[model samples]
Target: MKVKFYATFREMVGRKEVEVHGVKTVGELIDYLAEHYSPDIKRELLETPRVGPNKPIDGMILVNGHNVLHLKGLDTELKEEDEVHIFPPAGGG
Candidate 1:
């Protein structure tokens, strides 16, 4: 599977995209990234929003353009042909 990183996430991982193997779910993917790259990647990808529902992470994880929140969250299944997009928490003035 191909995972794409955006914004500060790309900087955190030091790459725009990567090809991962053997991860079957979003959670597994995050674990794989943390194991291979920075351990901080897990916290960045799975932070809980301070003032929202106490679930879904603060950032976004998408599979084939569909937000994982709308699919199965961390349990969302992944396929080799699927494209995963990871975006850091949005911020603006």
Candidate 2:
């Protein structure tokens, strides 16, 4: 499977895409990334270690073009060739 990052997430991994295996759910993928890449990514993406709702990070986490928040959240399932995209929270009015 391929996990693609955008905005700040892209900066965290220092790349736009990464290949991963042994993950079947979006939550698992996040766990795997936290272990191998940076734990901070997990914190930010998961919205943990946060303060109120004004944090600098709060983005859309998508799986195969579907918003995880509307699905099963981090429990969203994944299959082979599935693509994950993390986009920084939108701004401006």
Candidate 3:
């Protein structure tokens, strides 16, 4: 699975795309990424300070142009060739 970070997330992660191995659900991917990155990213990605591995985020996570929320939220299963996009809330007027 290919995970793509955007905007501030990309800046924080320092990479646009990351290829993960043996990841089944979006929740697992999030846990893996948070463990790899700095504390800042871990906090930003997690819903609460003491939340579990599958905590949901207020932001949006897209799987192949489709919102993960519509599929199965954090439990959304990913397959090879699938593109997962994480985006922060957009604010404009």
Candidate 4:
């Protein structure tokens, strides 16, 4: 799978995209990124803890142009051909 980083995430990882393997779910991919990239990546992706049964995410994670929050949050499944995009939180007025 090709994981693409946007905004600050690109700077944190020092690249725009990377080839990730051995991860089947969005959560697993985040763990892999934190290990291979920086711990900040994890911090930016996941926020606080699960509220009830919903996983609260800090930023936006999209799988094939679909928001994971709308799917299954971090538990969203991934495929070898899937394109993952990660974006940090944005604040504008």
Q: How does candidate 1 score on lDDT? A: 0.86
Q: What is the Å distance of residue 15 in model 3 from its true position?
A: 1.0
What C-alpha lDDT do the candidate models reach, one value each?
0.86, 0.79, 0.78, 0.89
Winner by lDDT between candidate 3 and candidate 2: 2
Q: TM-score each candidate.
A: 0.89, 0.81, 0.79, 0.89
Q: Candidate 4 has what TM-score? A: 0.89
Query: Number of backbone collisions per candidate, in order?
Result: 0, 0, 0, 0
- Least lDDT summed over 10 consecutive residues: which range in candidate 1? 47-56
Look at candidate 1 and tell me the lDDT of residue 86.
Answer: 93
| Residue lDDT tens for model 2, 1-93 | 888988787888889999998898887888898898878787876664542444423577778898887788767889988988888666679
Comparison by lDDT, 1 against 4, better one: 4
Between prediction 2 and prediction 4, the one with superior lDDT is 4
Best by lDDT: 4
Q: State, as a TM-score between 0 and 1, how close model 2 is to the true structure.
A: 0.81
| Cα lDDT tens digits for candidate 4, 1-93 | 999999999999999999998899999999999999988998876754433255578778999999999999888999999999999877788
